[model samples]
Target: MQRRIIIAGGGTGGHIFPAIAIANALKKIDPETEILFVGARGKMEMEKVPQAGYKIEGLEIAGFNRSNMFKNLLLPFKLLKSLGQARRIINEFKPQAVVGVGGYASFPILRKAQGKGIPTLIQEQNSFAGKANMVLGKKAKKICTGYDGMEKFFPADKIVVTGNPVRGNITQSSVTREEAAQHFGLQRGKTTVFAVGGSLGAKAINEALHPLLASFVEKDIQLIWQTGKPYFETAKTAAAAYASHVKVFEFINLMDFAYKAADVVISRAGALAIAELCVVKKPVIFVPYPFAAEDHQTFNAQSLVNKKAAILIKNDDAAAQLGTTLFSLVQNKALMEQLEENIGKLGNTNADMVIAKQVMALIG
Candidate 1:
């Protein structure tokens, strides 16, 4: 008999990508497995999930507003409505298992699924668990975590340290640096620094890089920048003066190539980004977003920094320090190589497969 499952999550690429990777893994393990995704309406996953070749159902839900209390007045109604919608979807799909990957829509869907006695699993991608996942952990049949010491969040017995699921294209990349540079129209003579601030772009990182564009050219450094949507035009304009040495885009769809071309990386320390960087085994300068829930991004970067596998720059200091830091690191081939070796040891190339086995075991 074909096994049917539903995976729920997504407000950001961090959640969406892992959810898709797990879904793909399940399919690979059992070609007859039927997978469906549940995400918040109008969120990135609504678009990205289908792009990954999966069926998705969107719920009308939103997270609590920490800034404006008035915006949260409707949260209760939205939650109830989303729960009802989730129940309807579950009834129609009749899934044997429901997995939650920690996003705005995850709580209601998993909560409803658990109430119905369906086997449930929640994948916690951060070193610190989010409030949504914390609440769902109690009822979850299994809790898969990306970092160690997760006993601080979920039950120790329930937790499985599966690491985070990185996109298969990245872990299995066979693209050579020369081929990647040629594809991106970059010359191979100089060190290449790749900067990405997640799927939406980080305003601070964009602003920091804007002034240093010409300096990178002057230093004979090549850059591949993913400026994200809001900063694309500005980044494009800034890179125009250094056309031969710099490339800028709102989003880089060809990330495998970008990873190959990067001798070093500048990025926000989102869990998914950290996972991909580890798998790529690149030296990274992480400017963790300060406002991440419980300041988890800093913890994520600190974990690697403690092992001397990556550099850490506080978000507040990035603008003033990033340029100098990049220049210094580019000149220090020894330190870069050291970071590469240590970080490569931390990579988990089979996280997707691990999660797949756990999901099947819990549901079976």
Candidate 2:
């Protein structure tokens, strides 16, 4: 029989990348496997998934707005519409198994699949599970997770610790520091710091790093900044004066090279970000996004900090203290090495493969 699968989710890189990784792994195992992606309309996955060489269908869906009650008034209609769309997609696709990587679109597809008596899997990419996954857990046959001790969040029997899947290129990258520096047009000898706040950008990190650009230039430090879309223009204007030492981007297409070029990294402690950082084995200072559900970013970062694998800076203190703290990190060679070694120990490079195998097995 032909094996057909449906992978659903995506609003951010944290979800999209892992879904792609798992899809790629599934393909590698059986090149003839038919995989279809279901995502929310207007989400990044619509573009990103196809670019990664897979077919994706978008449903008319949007997540709840906690701050705006008016926006949520239309949510019930959207949810009903999306559930109808999901059922049609599942019926037409006739997938042997459905995998949900947590996102707004995931719930409807997984819920419908479970209702139809199809095998289902939910990949929870956070230390704390998202509400969508929590709700879907009752009917899901398996739950793949990036962290341990998640019995409180889901049925312990259903949980499988597969870790989060990072892009294959980054995990297997052979690009040297000098080669990566040349890729970014940065000088080889200078201390390079890569600061990122994920794909959408972090306002606090951009603001904190903006005032310190001149200080970095004065000290002959090299910088790679991913300012995200909203802050790009302003960040570009500030970086214009020191173009030689600074490279500012709205989004980084070549993350493999970016990870290779860094001596130190400052980033948000998103689950996917933490997984990639572990693979890159770089010294890191994480600023957990405080507004995240259950303050999960802090929990994600704390897991590493407890193990002395990374340093954590609170969001409130980030703008005031990040510059000075990063300066100290860059100067401490011993601490940098310690962090790199310890974090590297946590990297699970074969998570995509593990997830694919388990999903196949559970369905069989």
Candidate 3:
């Protein structure tokens, strides 16, 4: 029988990319498997999902505003409306199973699916589960996790450690170091550092690195920096004086090359980024985004730090500590190699395939 599945989530690349990876994996395993994405309207998934060649339906939904009480007045109405929309989508699509990837849209769709006795699976990317996932986990047929010890958050029997699914280009990249350096117009034999702050760019990282451009050139280091859109112009302007050693981009489209070129990386400790770094096996200095839900990014980074697989610099301390941290790690060959080896052990290149098979099992 032909299978149909709904993958729900979005808001950030961390959520959307994993969802897409799973969708692609499902198709690869069973070409006739039909997949539909459910995301919140105006979120990145609406555009990204379609671009990945899947049909998507968006609900008029928004997460509760924790910082401001006044803004949450209409949240009840929105939730009620989205629940109705989710029900309609479920009925119209008749999915064999629904997968929740942890975003505002996942709650309603998974809730409705569970209520109807349809199997639902959740992909919780963070070590510290989000509230939405915690609630939904109660009724989900299975909960796929990126980190271990998630049994504390979800039912132990329902939890499976699948690791986070990373984009194929990253996990399967064949880009050589020489090709990577040439792509960035950088010279070989110079230690390269790739600093990325997620898809939208991280302000703390950009600001911390801005004053250190000259130092990078002085040390003969090469930098491939993704400054995100907000800080791009200023970062580009600042990096112009040392153009030979520094490359500044608003967003990097070819991340595989960036990973190949780097001896060390500076990144926000988002789950997806960590997953990719592990797959690529690079020594990383993580600056956890402080405002993340439940401060889960910190938990994500600490998980690796505990395993001796990565380093952590708090967001508040990045300005003062990131530069020193980066320079020291890049120069420490033994530590870098150790980190690379330990982190590599944590990478699961087949997470998408594993999750897809799990979803298929629920259908059976």
- TM-score, every prediction: 0.97, 0.97, 0.98
Candidates ranked, most accurate by lDDT first: 3, 2, 1
RMSD (Cα, Å) for all candidates, in order, is 1.2, 1.2, 0.9
Task: Give one digit per residue, the lDDT tens place, for model 3 in 66-151.
Answer: 78989899999999999999999999999999999998999999999999999999999999999989999999999999999988
| Model 1 quality (TM-score) | 0.97
> Candidate 1 vs candidate 2: which has greater lDDT?
2
Please report how far candidate 3 places residue 308 from its true position, in Å. 0.6
Which candidate number maximizes lDDT? Answer: 3
Global Cα lDDT for candidate 3: 0.95
Q: Write the per-residue lDDT of candidate 2 for residues 147-254, one digit (tens) a residue.
A: 998999999999999899999888888888889999889998889999999999999899999999998989899999999999999999999998988899999988
- For model 3 the local lDDT of residue 246 reads 97
| Cα lDDT of model 1 by residue, 1-364, tens digit | 8899999989999999999999999999999999999999989998999889999999999987767899999999999999999999999999999999988988888998999999999999998889889989999999999999889888899999999999988888899989999988998867999999999899888899999988987888899999989999988887888998899888988899999999999999999999999999999999999888888899999999999999998898988999999899989999999999999988998998999999999767
Give the alpha-carbon lDDT of every model. Answer: 0.92, 0.92, 0.95
Ten-residue region with minimum lDDT total, candidate 3: 322-331
